[model samples]
Target: MPIYIAIFCVLPLLAGLIPEYLVCRFTRRKWWKVLPPLAVAAITALVTAGRLSVWESDVSPVTQLLFVPGVPAAFALLGTLLGWRLWKRLWGPRVVKDRRGG
Candidate 1:
């Protein structure tokens, strides 16, 4: 149970990081901007996969619709929003002073 919880928690983070790293390494675009959507997508994918794999034998419609995707989707949204806030705080704006002729 703990292992399952751990896997659920970590998989989305890993999935989020993969796209961030790829964008940073391969393209000129800022990786931070892409993280939120990617994180959400990744979390969704992970949750869906986990549900299908773990409960395929004993699946029911309610479990299929609610438990399998709902929690992770919520987590993904929260995580992405948090990540975006952090990214903004960390990398947003710049202070520059005007240099005028003396």
Candidate 2:
């Protein structure tokens, strides 16, 4: 039970942190920063849905590996949002000062 919780809940959230930081750090545009992670989440949801819809007795190894539970994606979304907030706080837009006394 504990292991299941850790794998499904804790690990994904932690896994998500890096991608978000990298995205925020590398991407200059606001849209660019957000698009990648959302695309990941969307892809995961689609895959999960497709797998669930098709009833199969023999699941492929690839499919099994790719079979990500929805919880992880949700947690990851939360993690990305947190990362964005942190980035905004740390390296967000700054107010430029006038060269001469205004």
Candidate 3:
């Protein structure tokens, strides 16, 4: 049985998270959250374009030039969330009181 599910999920999640984590660590800023998804989206777009641009492919000329193969923001956001959740779980989440009564 192929472990394609795990492989695909883990790789993109890490790729999306690492840069975001590092930037947040160094800058200690909340705005750094934007970086992860945007970076991942850019990477996805570039890779898609690169693959489509190869010879003998039927990719549209506009797609090759504009690199608009697919939108990664949605997937990127999902990956970012998953990565953060995994990281937090590994490190142990901090104890915080909930304002809402449970």
For lDDT, the strongest prediction is: 2
lDDT of each: 0.59, 0.72, 0.59
State the lDDT of candidate 1 residue by residue for 1-102, as single tens digits.
887665555555454544444444455566555765765777578767776655556657566756557655665555555655555566668787889875
lDDT of 2 at 87: 76
Residue pair clashes in candidate 1: none
Supply candidate 1's per-residue lDDT for 102: 54
TM-score of 2: 0.63
Decoy 1 TM-score against native: 0.47
Off by over 4 Å in 3: 54-76, 83-102
How far is 53's C-alpha from truth in model 2 (Å)?
3.9
Off by over 4 Å in 1: 17-58, 94-102
Worst 10 residues of 2 by lDDT: 60-69
* Candidate 2 lDDT tens digits, 16-102: 766787789888777877675777677677777776744464656455544365667777777777777777788888898889977
Model with the higher lDDT, candidate 2 or 3: 2
Q: Each model's TM-score, in the order given?
A: 0.47, 0.63, 0.49
